[model samples]
Target: MIVKHGSTTFLKVIIFLTGIAVLALCVWLPEIAIRDARVHPDTAFFLIPFLLCAYGFCIAFSVALYQAYKLLTYIEKNNAFSELSLKSLKIIKKCAFTVIFLILLGIVSLRVLAKVTGGDDAAGPISLCLMGILATSIITAIVDALQKPLKNILELKPEND
Candidate 1:
């Protein structure tokens, strides 16, 4: 059975956006925060972790998005879910967890640091966006996992043919 490749274009665009977002969050944002650290230590603490997660997210997101691209290509060729896809998905899942962990740790650390240094909002929209992105990736992993059984079933050739 031939697989479809129509959605790959969509995936590419998403991957591009995510990459840009990572750059903005990781490199640019952290630098600004660090530069402003003398004036705002509390801000720097939060920004540091945000940078870490952003870079991490960049690497993880790239891998997953690339794998998705590869998966689409494989589908175009009517290949089953190869080890590549499975490995990629596993990495993606791990990345999501890591992001979540880093995020949680950052929040707790920032909250305490904030109280000591006197800052009201340690975490803003950036944290929320990261959490949302990680959550969505997790859900996607679940749905992607379901594809295994279906692919196996589909791969079974008709005996008569």
Candidate 2:
């Protein structure tokens, strides 16, 4: 009905906006890093590895967003419970896991770098990374929970039809 279409449209808009926001962040983060490197040349060494990890996170996030958008499309098309929808959810879940892994690796590297440099105060950044990991893990768990019921429904669908 009208309500269903409206809800999907709103979700699609939100997804589009999220993609744009991420794109902006992707562009802005490097500029900030380069600027900081220029101001504090010694910190430049740390920036490269951190930036690489950040870019990896961005890529995974973008993939998850795209998959979510596709999932919304599937729902709009009355195929919410279909194989394509399931695949999209699976991809999103994997992307969440990737993000969590990247954040953890980045945190470890940051800790090692801090130690090598006589232990700079890295508690703030580490805390942020922990939060990011927690959020990604929750997303992954939610997607996983959804996947099981979806798979069961898919299995039962054929029998019903």
Against the true structure, what is each candidate's TM-score? 0.67, 0.91
lDDT scores for all predictions?
0.63, 0.89
Candidate 2 on 5-54: residue-level lDDT in tens? 88888988998999999899999998999898898787689898889888
Q: How many residue pairs clash in model 1? A: 0
User: What are the root-mean-square deviations of the candidates from the true structure over C-alphas?
Assistant: 4.1, 1.8
Which candidate ranks first by TM-score, i.e. highest?
Answer: 2
lDDT of 1 by residue, 33-77 (tens): 667787766456566665665576567666666666666666666
Lowest-scoring 10 consecutive residues by lDDT in candidate 1? Answer: 151-160
Residue 65 in candidate 1 has what lDDT? 63
Q: How many residue pairs clash in each candidate?
A: 0, 0
